[model samples]
Target: MARKIIKTNPNLIELIGNLKDKSYNEEVAIWKDVASRLEKSTRRRTEINLSDINRVSEEEQTIIVPGKVLANGNLDHKVTVAALNFSKTAQEKIEEAGGEGISISEIIEKNPKGSNIKIVE
Candidate 1:
């Protein structure tokens, strides 16, 4: 049987379209890179392990997870994290560290071109 390919959310699709029209060529290239990644392997669902989250640097634009963010690692730096779902412990830990936990859609809305975004699987 062939695997089904899931489509990205309409909001995300719109964001990608906007990104394509950006004036800055470098930014447009970066956005295209991220969009390309998102387009491949349409599983519809995504999950991020907290252990991986802890490895990211604070200076990064933002971390986005398509599925859920778990609470299995220590978060020492203050960084913005946006995802589809977050564990109870993950939410608390992010807030406790002075970081914002938001939805991926919100992140895309704020930074359509993904200018500094680091996507964690």
Candidate 2:
């Protein structure tokens, strides 16, 4: 048997709803994928660090993280990162590197079709 996910955060619930709606309306698989990822329990969700982002990303790329972004290391290039949550230092580091750290809903609003968006774990 499978367990049902019980998300407590109202903001998260809203984001997931928006993601599903966007995916259905726009016929975009990426949004659906992100929504499923976000539906997981907190312990099962991803926690990516700046170093990993720097290693796998290129300058001026758009990356979406379904979970939280940590500030463990430094970022050397400019990129746009959208995630469900961002640590204070993580947001600061991205800004310091000339990058933008925004929310997933904002990203979906900016790119409804989810064009050229890369999912980072």
Candidate 3:
């Protein structure tokens, strides 16, 4: 028997490829985990909210979301967030709270070793 592969969006395929390359080049397992999650079926992909991140994260923490970050609530403190996609309101809210919202690729380039990072979804 062979394992079945799930097809994902083209953009997601590129993201996953980059993540796998970064994981191998940097020897970081977290990147691989993030890549794998992004490879899931679109319906199965991770989708998180600011409130959920607030629940699981601490102030000034670095967090990553493999799918999308939605602006459904408030952020209590400053934090850095990286995600494949962020809602317009989410980006605004993050910055308004003195936090930063960045693309996952940018975060990967800056932190290849994936240190002190929490996967929000």
Candidate 1 lDDT over residue span 22-79, tens digit each: 5255455655544555555655456666668878656434787756788888778788
Candidate 3 residues lying further than 4 Å off, grouped into runs, are 1-8
**Relative to the true structure, how large is the alpha-carbon lDDT of every model?**
0.69, 0.95, 0.90
lDDT of 3 by residue, 40-87 (tens): 777787889999988888889999998899999999899999998999
- Compare the candidates by TM-score and give the number of the best one: 2
Better of 2 and 3 by TM-score: 2
Segments of candidate 1 deviating more than 4 angstroms: 5-44
Candidate 2, poorest ten consecutive residues by summed lDDT: 2-11
Global local distance difference test of model 2? 0.95
List TM-scores for all candidates, in order: 0.66, 0.96, 0.91
> What is the TM-score of candidate 3?
0.91
Using lDDT as the measure, name the better of candidate 1 and candidate 3. Answer: 3
Q: Is candidate 1 or candidate 2 better by TM-score?
A: 2
